[model samples]
Target: MKQLRANREKGMTLVELLAALVLVSLVVILINSVFLFTEKNADSLSKETDVQQNLLLGMKVLTKDVRSTDGEQVTVEKNRLLLGSDEYAAKNGQLLKNGQPVAGDIQSFEVCRPPKGAVYREDELACKPLIAGEADENRIIVILEGTANRAGKSRRLSAMINMER
Candidate 1:
């Protein structure tokens, strides 16, 4: 009886093996779920970041264009700007430069000549009409707003661009 008991104790029983397998499967399932959740979040965040960077780049290009053009060659309207022969606008959810897409996922683009000597404050562009005696300013206020489709995120950029020429 002692010899038989020693042989049986040399290995796990069928029930114990099955239980171990079940435990391992449960652990694998839990880890897989966590990995999938993390992947989804990472994708969403990446999309949001892409949208933000695109907006920033678009703003930089617009600023460069405005600064390079002469003040007399600049035209500001409610939703469009013309810097000499170059035209910038937001249309059909895109930021367009001379009818070509500059950036995608844009919601709105607004251009205005703020009152003379007006300054930008927190959320206050103050794009009001100029007073009769006020001199025309050599700058423009541009606002760009956009949304990321899959990420459900939005961003806005406001700039005061000065025409140097």
Candidate 2:
């Protein structure tokens, strides 16, 4: 029987092992940093998307309501909008529709009379936006302006609706 003799010691040396460990740690650290940055970016993007969706939903609801009712039925007060039996108001930094919360983080909600080029005043509220030209009186249109915010950023929404009695 022939036996093989060991030529030299095998396996990784201490320095080689240490170098491998350092390389692995660096890769791990880089991956961790990238994931951390991605997480932060995703969080911010989620907040922004939420605010935008809320603003769009709010505008849609307002438009539907305005279109269903005549201008004479909707009243624009200081910080509230009355549409027939329903009311949309801003209170406690929230927007409410008929006393129920419809949106959050609302900075402002206003009803504007574009034809008059002015916001509706509590004392000067009108059924139809006063226009200089002699236009159709059967249809009246109004504007709803709103602002929604999340974190430190904000978004604005504007909707114009025309109603015919």
Candidate 3:
């Protein structure tokens, strides 16, 4: 007597195999894209941080000197500021006199004319005429413009130096 035998298949069909391969490939591609985007964002953030730090440091140093400008003659010309004291002179001017600083018997300060394309605005006190006029008891305003990067982001920082006697 002959017995009939049934065939059993235990493997996936070609279509199912192809579908799984495609899904896995898509997931891998999506993950890679996310990583790339994150990396780019991190790099941009770093650049911005660096720029901010530089600007802040510049402002702090300038502010300290301005606040300590006691008995110092303050001169403002366009974008420059000069603070002169008997001991030392602080200058932020465009032209240095005689390759040496312009000296004064008392403490003196000077700010150089700002470079072209730099924006500046002074307070009423700071803009007072340097002639035969009583010095105003108000503080001087000094605003400095920071260099912009390729991203077109710019920063402006200001310092106020009291001209109080």
Candidate 4:
């Protein structure tokens, strides 16, 4: 009887083996779920596409406005730009040109004149009037900043426009 008892103790019970198997399976399932959840949340490619689309739409409109402008009395501002008769501004989650919303999901539009007064020309130095009473300028950089509506990814795009008379 003692020998038989020792042999039984050396072998694992059926219940013990089943319980171990169940625990391992459960642990594997839990780990897989965690990884899937993390991957879903961290997906950034879709967000990048959204931001790119917004940028393209905004840039298209801005390009047309910049190109069609008469290029006379150009005015550059932080949030607004005046080229010929067309005007662009950043307002209310949209890009506005001539008081009409041209692009949506745009957070900001900036029209900056690079400080090239010394480089552009001595007379046109750094925000100084090119010619008193004359507002026509040469070139400017337009920047559009936006975010994806769903993913919330923020991006910026810029273009340099050489004003033509």
Q: Please give the range of 10 consecutive residues that has the lowest summed lDDT in model 3.
A: 103-112
Indicate which candidate wins on lDDT: 1
Candidate 1 wrong stretches, greater than 4 Å? 7-14, 126-136, 149-152
- Best of the candidates, TM-score: 1
Order the numbered candidates by lDDT, best leading. Answer: 1, 4, 2, 3
Clashes of each: 0, 0, 25, 1
Which lDDT value does model 3 have at 54?
50
Q: What's the CA error at residue 144 for candidate 2, in Å?
A: 7.6
CA lDDT, every model vs. true structure: 0.81, 0.64, 0.49, 0.72
Candidate 2 residue-wise lDDT, 1-165, digit = tens: 123334344577899999999999999999999999999989877777776776677777777877888778877554677888999877765678988888765677766444533444434433453445544333333323334323555666654455654
Instruction: Write one digit per residue (lDDT tens) for candidate 3, span 1-165.
Output: 123332335577899999999999999999999999999888877766665565455455555655677634655555445566322223442122323443211112333323323234543213324433343334555554444544766544455555455
**Could you give me the TM-score of model 2 versus the true structure?**
0.68
The better-scoring model by lDDT among 1 and 2 is 1
Q: Model 2, which residues run further than 4 Å from truth?
A: 1-9, 117-151
- Assess every candidate by TM-score: 0.81, 0.68, 0.53, 0.61
Query: Ten consecutive residues with minimal summed lDDT in candidate 1?
Result: 126-135
Q: List candidate 4 stretches off by more than 4 Å.
A: 1-35, 38-43, 116-136, 148-153
Q: For residues 5-33, could you state the per-residue lDDT of candidate 1 as single tens digits?
A: 89878988899999999999999999999
